[model samples]
Target chain A: MLARLRWTEFGRDPGAAIARARLISTLGPLIALLLASIFFSIRTDRFLTTENLSLITQQVAVVGVLAIGQTLIILTAGVDLSCGAVMAFGTIVMTKLAVTHGVNPFLAIALGIGVCLGFGVLNGLLVTVLRLPPFIVTLGTLNIAFALTHITSNEETIANLPDPVVFFGNTFRFAGTTITYGSVLAVALTLITWFVLTKTVGGRHVYATGNNPDAARLAGVRTRRVLLAVYATAGLLYGIAALVLVGRTGVGDPQAGQSANLDSITAVVVGGTSLFGGRGSVLGTLVGTLIVGIFRNGLQLLGVAAIYQFLITGVLVILAVAVDQLSRRRQA
Target chain B: MSAVAARVPVLEARGLVKHYGVVTALDGADFDLYPGEILALIGDNGAGKSTLIKALSGAIVPDRGEIFLNGTPVHFRNPLEARRNGIETVYQDLALAPALDIAENLFLGRELRRRDIIGIVLRVTDRPRMLREARAHIADLKINVGSMKQSVETLSGGQRQGVAVARAAAFASRVVIMDEPTAALGVRESGMVLDLIREVRARGTPVVLISHNMPQVFEIADRLHVMRLGRRVATITPASHSMTEAVALMTGAASSQGPTKG
Candidate 1:
């Protein structure tokens, strides 16, 4: 009788239904990724080669890493407009310190990372302490970081980077797959971020703060500190992305991260991570980055105009957010 | 009053005064809660019951007052401080993360870590232990939640209230202050909450229940503290007054009866 009435499993949890809905939300993007790949492969012979696939990974790695950081920020219901600018300023500082000033390569990189992290700290302070909107603070920092990059680098590209600076661009051939260490870095960072979000108490706090800051505070969470840590962590990720940028370009270009802010955000949303925050994953972000890369490569192969290519990508991002909102509304 | 009660109360607020510009939320409110007792606080609308609970829970700082935990004067600058001092509150809004599961909600601030060396090196949570313990804990409340993994957002209103009450019951060592725990609950769910309150009191933790529901106030409460305007007017037992007498006291239709001098 006790065995019959046992509540170990009430058949299936009603939550399974909600979980299924979430799975469908993520699967929509995955299917889109697969379809885009198929569409590109059939249209052109050049799109399917292992060499081209490796190149796409290379193109997306920096943005993917940035998106990983942006994913954390967005998970806390904040956006980082200065991400690309942080990377750009980072590249300038790194190259200028190592090449022009002849600082130690490692020290130069550390300084560059420090510079990027500072923007995050500043962003955190403005948002938490000053109670400023994240969008405005990051926008101001984006202009500031961009201007600093220009002024610091004399609006010029620093060339003839050291061999160690472009070390991430070093490639290894595995069968037909040409793998760059930068791609490995992106994957590693994403996995590490995934572990933090899913396994740690602090990770849970991040979700709580984003889900409802007032509730989080009442529940005894230090919300301001959580927000500060998230913004700072994102800054650190941008700094790391700057390293990848240097490796890929093999030169310190102040203009390298110009398009990254929007691109990274697009990747994050496409990955099924919600802009509303407290609902998304780093793994989904990686897929979103891949989708963007595949579309860009395919559109180029189809001889699509740069403007039209731009229009298509922008439309896809908007469409993804629209779908996300619709699904969220239904759930609510 | 028992010997321990006469010595020192579990939780006490002495002459708490709070103001919002021209309006006074709590004006010289004096409150006391003894260990292993359910002290029901009921008042008319805007009678400072919430303001008093807020001061006790560290949700708001009183303009001028002092709170004592086990007779030691405590200054709670924030809710975290109050929690550290063993004061947990279940607000009317049920401060829970909607996306997180039940186990996560139960262990939100003070999550248990793993026991082995891997736990020492890494900050990974003890998920299995948390789930097992949360299951047993919520089971103690006799709530029929489908799964420990279910997000609080997926829960019915009653289940959500159950989670909030369970969280407070599990953590609160000194006192648990609940603000209208059964406000939105149906008849059965509200009954469950009252039972939970009794169970909490049975565990020897003092409970300050703030509710507008008079029958509920009378049913579970060992003693009732009636508030009018901004001051506690009377402290009566279920046997001391009928429901109509309590209503009359609250609306000021009858003269205030001060706490009976023993």
Candidate 2:
């Protein structure tokens, strides 16, 4: 009798339906993680070590930050193909300001943030004013940002980053497990994003605008302002992530993080945020990031070559999208 | 009638004309909207009821007309202007964002921002206050909402209409116009909405309801305006005419007779 009532309640609520869908999507990654961990644990005693867990956290930090931005854009029924290039641009700007201009490192970080915001504004204006599809707009910006990164940096790595900035990444600890500042930042950001998405008015507006723009307009949401704000915020987060990436690598390389945009989007989608928008969570994206982190880590442990890793990632993206399409059809 | 008892109509349109290219959607339409009255605008589909409402609500510019507000000529350049001038329209779509919850939907356009007279900071939302007010306001209208935090997409057809009415009433200064608020609702839900319309009218806010349901029109409306072929056929008291007479006037069968007397 209790089971029957629960089923009826679930049938009546779309929120419940969405919750159920999220749960189902998570099963794939959770099972994969478990099977891989067990296989590695039996084959290699080092797999379950605290040191390996710490390594995974540090490695996942870059992709995890970018995925948060992708999650926001996807929730708004848009995509930002320029994210990876934007990170490269941010690094280039940060390096130039710090190395060439001899600016304070903290001030250089601020300058890098400003540059990303400007790029975001350009994208927002071009998309909103010109009425271009976000995909096309971001695609154009991607090439532009990529070329500009090279032009600005002269295709060279800016080495010997200021000690203060590197310190931000190098700080380490072990509290039941090894953790770094980057991982801490990533986790903190994920939590903050979860709160904002679930608890704030502006966040609700994002969902509304993404779900149905016409309805949101009539509701007087100021959708244009909201869209511009989302893009700007994404750029700012990308800038911060760029800072972390540069510090983590201990060098500002223009070509580094070239695959960030694709990897972030893959994590977001795999975590169950629909590309069509109106439904998702930051927690899901975290899980998605972990899946990627573990998959890469486990594959490397299995002696798979780095080139094969790219092919596998490509196949997984296709599989994830196909699953999403199928689930949408089922729901409809 | 005593002068105090004889209130000047809040809104009046005289010889209102509207044209869409070669189409004459409304021609010389006349309407009088009195304060504290539930006025029903009824007609067959495409009988220019919408065109006339659009003109009154300032959604479309009238080709030729004189709209008088409180006995003074007024021209609204846009819907926002009309709203400022005490005219609010709830379209058939309700215009509520589905992903947002009830509180956000209610305060979407004209949100109350915090005002600090001194150096003290303020949280504008005042969630507790807004929630309490929203809850009390909907209860005053006597509509049942499952929860204030539930998204609009979770609302039923009738409940959504109630939300739309509540939103219009909460913000509108003088007049609230509902375009087919009951057309999509169930029988009981339609009855609930009609009851809310009566409550709105009792509060001395004039309501201009556009509905096709004759029973609903007769139930809530104090005065009925019939439109036929882009012209006002007649305006009559509901108590003075049966539903049959109203429909005949609406369909143009009794256009020459004007409003049929009891």
Candidate 3:
């Protein structure tokens, strides 16, 4: 019924053109992915192999989780500079308790989650109650968290973790394929985040709060609470990702996640999520993460060094932001 | 006043006063809203219409006033409080979120949550029920909307006004107050909204419509409560006075000068 109404209203001329445009946009990324896969398959002997694909998946998993959290925060016109440091803090706290204090690994994991949730609460308090700008507040917290991680590890790496914990990190065999648990966890988080943001009341509240606080408030929506909740939830996810990071490395390093925040934010920006807020999707973020993963993997496969790949990724981020701005302007 | 055992006023205000720093916006204004009636409030710009509406809707707390709902004095801390008590104001801006679709906007503050408690929960919009109810309500008023799911941004001016009226009607239990709802609409759309106002009164919901348009006012209003400065200068029935008389009363040209903004 809706389609028929739209068809009759916007008819064959401009309507048909818009329909074509939407179809192209929906299919555009898939076409690009297929093309990239074909090009790499023809150029490189190892590109299509299970081992190489698995390596790429594991490499992007940590960054993917961070990007998902960043995407949620960014949708509310907010950013989390402390995401990386918070993850690092979680890693140190979990490892110190489990490895140094000989606490149950599961209990230590819970402790790590709790600590990260505390940081999230702090962020929420600073943003909502204190009415501080998210950028400045998170920047301060980022430095503070980074300092705490260093102090927790005593400026040294904590390694030689328990065998069971290490298994979570190193073991990747599933259905006769070499896929790590980190990769699986990343995929699960992405799906869950996507569903919540697109299909639930919690997600709609974020969009409403972002778009117009006054209207949402009039509608009986608790704007301050929703804003705080999103930031706190982001902080909690950083903690979970931190566990995966520590499990895989079999070591906890204070500096490990310091740069992950910047990379994840870049991927979110590139994934079509607006920085000014009120619009974005997890599915778009996945495609965006994939684009980054493929580009980095392809660059390395073609023997391009790390520095060049970093430079290319930086350029891609700028290009993505520019495109987003241009499209927004056109719509306006 | 021939009192035919005046039905209890749905909303009544006495000694209402508001202040912004040293400026006095409202000065002990008295108003009455009875059931099954349309009250037309008219005054010059800055004559306290905005201030009075704001106070009634809980946008501002009057410095001194006693508001009564059905003869019982009450205070609304905010607009939601007033709404929960059956007073819904359709503001000049309409208070509709432009980005949200029609259904979402209709259910904005009061979304219908499903019957569920926990784990892997499934939720779906009760679209059919909401749409059916909404359609039946509008149909009784003889208004037309192409679709309930279209964004308000895509709707024409009359359609938007219809939606706003529908929203106020859908929610309000006793009174629906419109603040210049037809001020920005085209000719035909304004007429449609006027029809809606009549239909609302017929359905027994007292409507407080604020407007300065004389013909539109005389056509729909049952009781014309003209305000000059801060006080109602005349409460003339449309059947008793011509449009010219009502305008004359509104502009303070009548023998009675009405109350000043003391």
Best by TM-score: 1
Candidate 3 — which pairs collide?
A169-A248
Runs of candidate 3 with Cα error greater than 4 angstroms are A1-39, A163-172, A322-327, B1-5, B116-147, B156-158, B183-192, B211-220, B224-262
Candidate 2's displacement at residue A318, Å, is 6.1
* TM-score, every prediction: 0.93, 0.82, 0.85
lDDT of all predictions: 0.86, 0.78, 0.76
Q: Positional deviation of B175 in candidate 2, in angstroms? A: 2.5
DockQ of every candidate structure:
0.47, 0.24, 0.28
Assess the local accuracy of residue A236 in candidate 2 as a C-alpha lDDT between 0 and 100. Answer: 80
Q: Model 2: per-residue lDDT, tens digit, B1-262?
A: 1112267878889998888889989988988887778888998988899998888888788999899988899998767778888787888874786656777677765544334431123223445556677787777777667567766666666677778888888777889999998888778667767878888877678899999988888888878888888987887777778899888877777654554311
How many collisions per candidate? 0, 0, 1
TM-score of 2: 0.82
- Over the stretch A87-181, how does candidate 1's per-residue lDDT look in tens digits? 99998999899999999898899999899999989999999999999999999999999999999999899988887777888888877799899
Interface RMSD of 2: 6.2
Candidate 3 lDDT over residue span A289-312, tens digit each: 777788788878989898998898
lDDT of 2 by residue, A211-310 (tens): 7776666555678887888888788888878877876788889898788888999888778777877666778888888877877887787788988878
Higher-TM-score candidate of 1 and 2: 1
Using lDDT as the measure, which candidate wins? 1
Pairs of colliding residues, candidate 1 = none
